[model samples]
Target: MEDSRDPQFASLSVGDSAVAVLVDRATDDADVIHDIELMTCSEYSHLCLGMPSDDTGDLAMYTNNKEMHAEDRLALWPAFHRDRLAADGRRFADEGYDFVVQHQVGSRFVDYMNHVGESTFGTPMPESLSVVEKFANTATTSHYLVLHQALMERRIPRGSKILMVPAASGVVTGFLSATVSSLEV
Candidate 1:
């Protein structure tokens, strides 16, 4: 765009303009539970990785209990989702995007992006970690924060596509894929 945009949203989409959302965290439980940060950090991470075990039989026991909060199953969910993203990047490249966002998983999330880019596509990965560094994460909006950060800096390529990954407890995870439609925002 030829006009200036709000600095806070430079690297992110302007509502439905950039992002095409498929799902939202709207459910009947949303009306009843307002405070979701009810658990300790360790307990939260445990939802993704179940308690450790030494014996195969013990592990199987965990598997039987409603999937036992099965560590392997829970762990594989994220892996499978992330692994397929590289292929998504590849397929979307022809559309002028290089898969330039939404690789976060933790502090090492950026590292994972570069690693996957190298192993899967033989290219250097772009980082979106500055979103949290510049402006702290707001639960589900972290991905947008990074996107906006990139846009504010004019780091994102105009018309290029980007990806946003958001995860929640109860094993809920999501992805938002969008194209940069404006240089101003």
Candidate 2:
């Protein structure tokens, strides 16, 4: 569905006077999450990413047997991004945002350290051994953080609407890599 009310967005065209806010789901993917951090280091970019927190108590839905802990939540990043990124990418490009803000996953919990094996000299490695397994989770957090900073810097107007294009078509159409202007003009 196309959203027409919001002025601030990620990838659409902002009228000469309108303020565009480009929001990317930073924690959505590993590559894009990395990109956000690279972009941020160069200069203070105006963008925002939404960070998922336990505030909603929805984390429980992810893990059925155990209460959703921080580690469990981190594990969900890859699937979450795989599920959501394409749609969001389309939104940013189609939205013509003036600024982009997003976040990727950040540090993990101590419990997550189990992934790593026994440390050298009887000391245990602080983190998981197969950190690659956690990359998606951490990346998700990174994206969220980067995007959050971006949003805070360039706050979108309260009433600005967001347009989210469906994912199935975006993936089918090869729209993921295209920038905001590249979308159907």
Question: What TM-score goes with each of the models?
Answer: 0.44, 0.18
By lDDT, the best candidate is 1
lDDT (Cα) of model 1: 0.42
Off by over 4 Å in 1: 1-96, 103-106, 113-129
- Encode model 2's per-residue lDDT on 107-146: one tens digit a residue: 3332342221122112332211122223433322332333
Q: Cα lDDT of all candidates, in order?
A: 0.42, 0.25
Looking at model 1, report the run of 10 residues with the lowest lDDT sum.
30-39
Candidate that scores best on TM-score: 1
TM-score of 1: 0.44
Ten consecutive residues with minimal summed lDDT in candidate 2?
165-174
